[model samples]
Target: MTSTPGNSTEKRQFHGDLIQLRGDRAAKAIWRRVPLASAGSENSIDEVALQEMLFRHADILALGEIDPAYRNSVPVCMELGTRAGAADALYLTPTGRIVLAEFKLWRNPEARREVVGQILDYARVLGSWSYDDLDREVRNRTQRSPCDIVSEAHSEVEEHIFIDNVARRLKRGEFLLLIIGDGIREGVRDIVAYVQEHSGLRFNLALIEAAVFRRGDGEDLIIQPRVLARTELVPRTVLVRKTILEETDDDPLEEHEPSPIEDENERFWRAVLEDFAFDDPEPEVPQPSRYGSVWVKVDGSGFGGWGLSFGAFLNRSQSGMGIYFTWRTGFPEEERVFDEIVGALSSNEELGSRLEGWKRWSAPSGPPRLGFSRNVEFVDGTTIRDFDEAVGWMREKFNRLVSVLHPECWRRLRAKG
Candidate 1:
């Protein structure tokens, strides 16, 4: 491979052309043949610009080519925590496949290796989280729900399915780690291989080299990204390791064995139900949801069979109560009843004012409801006196709501015809 001084220039061009040929050779050659428009030199591009460009045009990463149904999202908690360190960019697929990425200039070998370990650590932290926690964190950090973020980009995605997929994938440790940079040097693949060899079922790592060229001195930057190394095969075996203080994998809405806090929650709600019985001795008995939320149906006066209900909940994190209007029929009749009931309650100044500060929920799978919750510092270890105070608080709120709504309810009955 000896070359004369004149041949040295040709040798460099040949090597550059080989890299270009792997992707779009025609475009690369045409751009190379022309002089780039620039008032000054084009060597000052930084990593921030690279990160922003990739985030805006994530499809450029070609994630869908791997799985046609897969879509991308930017999680606000990409840095994970102080222990896992921060990542440059993060993405998730439709089926909950995580794509962790870092953008570097790749001029430094040590920095590149460090990013690989950093992203891997993020995966370990993510393993302990459920979709609910991630969704809540995403909303807290971005001021937008994770569901809304994904739906904005992929309008066709179903919310429940998307969320379910994320839980499944995180539990299984199925993720893709991309290390993207400009001017990637040699020996990076060896580093990826060594890490991949010892790694388990969590993630597959890849390297992409982005070559940025200027079209004219204008802001027309042309970026050509080529995959230096493809993603490694994910293991079929699932490896799940829960974070120390995370929720159990069981669905919170389903019935499960009662915990200590659940027992206390049940006792408190039972006393409240007895107070409710002073008016209607045979009112439906309250039962506990999987997370120990006590709920039962109450008469809606003119609504007939369609009842109003309340739920009292307790958990290690917080405790709360909710008032719901259960739908008796299909969507058309249900909506009519909801409007009528809400309107009556709102017309009563006392009842409507009390309902303020409550949160509302209208999901497809269940009836519409309003809820109020308070953080609990000691859920499982609350004193019996505390439970008595909770029962009294709920009883007072319930009596006030029912008393004020009674007159408005009669008005609703007269208008129903």
Candidate 2:
């Protein structure tokens, strides 16, 4: 069966509307939470809360804060002794009046030495953990044997040994350090500058500022530090650079063109028109609806002719026994012309006999009544077979009528080779 152009256009329009509706719904859903603040009125976010947020949004926390559960879960190995405890612990050392913390196992051993040196500098200037008794305790804690642990004569040397081991780990890049306090401490800045100049190791540092308020009732309002890091502000430009590099490496040698279906509908329509012009002409036709009237006009003049009116066809009966030609009544002169032409065609003995036989077989009975009013009208005639056959007959009769009315136009059309 042939496809109607109108059907294709209607389908395309329906699909376009569906796409637009879906896009509008998606836009509404995505922007719905824009007005709300993500975090509460807390002045600072603690390690626990930070860790939870990091876990929830894994992509953003690729190598940041340590979760408490993760830190305490590390297995203890007796071979390392007390050093095993240090390996598992997330330590916060005093950097002047502020605290500089390192999350457990965040970096390698090489990087750990750099962190320890910075922490030592911070401790020296802050004067919080002096190299006296606490230093001796730290050394005793690290020693493997009882003699080494009890030896207090060279407390300075023992302290150096313990600190040196930590320093070596920091140098090997073994952990991550987070600076947490009210504001930037001089000691922290000095150590940061020192690390930047001496060690080329890249470290991510978060500066946290907190506010504490005490009321007369002895209630303390603790405002936590708001974490700030360079990574959170914008997307990484390095990703874009890498993408460009990859795309450039796999560049194609040649470009391909799109298929004909990708062209616009208008272009397809133009092509179809061109094809039609270059080929044989298609026959003119008329179609009939299921329930319609059929009216045939027969002129008894020498050139006997027959004409059908759609209005009369529809008025015959609301069944498959008539044809309805609505355009006939609207153009009376054209109708008269068509009637004269059909009269001539029907005068042909063979054609007229076939027409009469078709009418006799399909004619409706009784005094023809108007099936409906206004839009619905009946014709004093008979139908023939289905709508398709009726349409074919009507088209032949119409072409004959056109030849009689405008002989010159018909001749001109036929002359085109």
Candidate 3:
């Protein structure tokens, strides 16, 4: 992207067809478009196959620009049951954007029109849905709470706010509907124009054409997927998006100033998170807690147990920090994990040595949290002096702590258990 003194022309870095160049003996791999079709009974590359691929690798959609929060989205389900019909695929972002995608093999005009109309119908049906309505459908398929799905990716998102946002997004018809097709040839602009003309709906629609190229037969096959088209956002959709942005800026929580404690905690965590790299594929970001005890949740069990998570946290008084484990009384999930941890520390000498001198205490009640704590001197006025150095200590402890607790110990326990 570049511009002149007063005017500019938009051009994509790569367009037309894909080519592979590797020095002098290059520019030879033409990489012809491989139509996404069921060539015969032997192969199963059809519309359903395309949807599965998109579900598995959602990052391919290139939809992060519409809602940056979409980076934290997870695949909800494929063929999600809706009044209009089952959508091809459904994705839910942390911010509650209902990303409805419809995959199609656009080798004919009839197919394109059907996809556009079907997606529009899905959007219309979804618009009239309530939070419970959507949740019921999702749970029926994935057996996961709507909040649980997004919260797994973004625990910082409050459950109430997540539900509220999803309801609001649905009511307002603010969905990012993707019409994914195999080599969408011609009539693309018409689809964009069609969405624009429908002033009644406030939907952001994109026509993504996936150009899947193949080189060889079965075993030695090379496949590459490319996005050839994108969303040309319309004025109606843009206006709605602008309104949403304005509302976000005017959020009640953001409108107010933070308290002194909030300020201190904010600085403390920011210093740690700024340079503290987490190893979890989906590391949960920390939100400043009013009480000062906020954990940067990590999957402690290599087996993806929801309750099996513990992260570095500042003690309630901001005087100490630790790697805390969450344990709920009488809950099988947490109890089994706690049992495993105790057994590992006692039986495994190597594991015990790695976590040497780590203190532990538990109250005689439910929701007991155990961890290894490190105290920091909180002598300076509001926050500790040289908070940077304190954060450095915390980072070192967290990295070594997770490496010890999470994988090796947990993996061994999982196999044994």
Candidate 4:
């Protein structure tokens, strides 16, 4: 019969349900619920459904009684196992129970005894072969083995073949026996208990009560498995919280020393001055007879003290200029003094107007300030070709200014000369 999606009888069986049994209790309860008649009466239910239930859950069944023919045909009912072995082969009896059939051997005068012994032997062999081995065997039969199946270290191919070859000898040791008709047959229960104890196996026996419900011209066997008791308990819940905060702050302010380049440059200039003093020869004492007065104009802006003497010698014979000294102040204090002189000149407007352009020198980050002074008429700004003239002018001024400010400096200069 054609069936709609999700409309199968199996799907309709359990829907919108919550099983509250915990762990093993759930497994045991489900086992007990299998209808006794359904388990015992092989022809009463659908074999496919029975196989599906057993294979899906790997459940063991207990049979109270079963049709001899169905029982003989299906000894151990397993859906996955039968399907794996023979995909197209139907291994179910007219009754719902799965039929397990295999060829066997017997060589004894006592036919029944030998058959029973052979059946036991077959059962032992089938039991020994694991599910993995059975799957491989099925794959081989279907010519669908991807690669040659390798045997496990402890596996024996002979055992698998032996199990398959025996038919009637095969028996379901602790398999559920379905007892059809009135009540369970006493012999069936004895066989079940015997198999359970002697076969060294375990099974869950499902006792189903079946009654024929007759209504007018219709009669049907109603089968129902006893409902196993169960209890439900709620699980505890846990709460968790996580929080993180980040902070950033500026570093505390601190004072830092001046750059190293400035320090090195200062040291270099001091060394140059010291070397110049060492190289120059001592000056001869002046004779009173040849003494002459010469006015040296010093400019203190460009070079230091040395430029003053040089400028004086260059302008010695100049008519009105005589020996003009020009120099620039290098220290802030010295610059202040020069500024005062400039201020004084400014107070006297006559002298202030006579003064030429002055260049104030200052270091980039330091406090020291300096300026050069010179006579505008004698030293023509147009005629002064390069930095040398400016240097000479500043040096001359430095020497004169130093002499005036500290006479001791003048004495030292003369002594060095």
Among the numbered candidates, top TM-score falls to 3
lDDT for position 371 in model 1: 46
Cα lDDT tens digits, model 4, 33-109, are 22223344643333344334333322122222332333323222222233223321213222222323221111112
Q: After superposing candidate 4 on the true structure, give the runs of residues whose Cα lies further than 4 Å from its correct spot.
A: 1-125, 136-182, 202-214, 219-221, 225-417
lDDT of 1 by residue, 1-417 (tens): 675655432221111322234264455422321222222435556677767788777877766554444445544334433236656666765445667777775544577677777767776666556665566556655676666766665665545445556766666566777788775555677777787666654466778777666543546666767776755565533234742222334323222234443355556666776736424343454543223344444454324534444444444322344333344445454446557767744576666676665446663435565545454345433434466676676676554444443344445544655
Cα lDDT of model 3 by residue, 88-184, tens digit: 8899887777889888876556877888888889987886776667887989888987778767766555454466577667656667888887666
Clashes of 2: 49
User: Which digits, one per residue and each the tens of the lDDT, describe model 2 over residues 280-360?
Assistant: 123222222111222223222112222222222222223232222212234444444444435544576654443342221
Predicted model with the maximum lDDT: 3
Off by over 4 Å in 2: 1-171, 185-198, 201-203, 230-417
List clash counts for every candidate, in order. Answer: 1, 49, 0, 48
Per-prediction RMSD in angstroms?
12.0, 37.1, 17.5, 45.7
Question: Model 3: how far is 69 from its true place, Å?
Answer: 4.8
Count of backbone collisions within predicted model 3 = 0
Candidate 2 has its poorest 10 consecutive residues by lDDT at 10-19
Clashes by residue pair, model 3: none
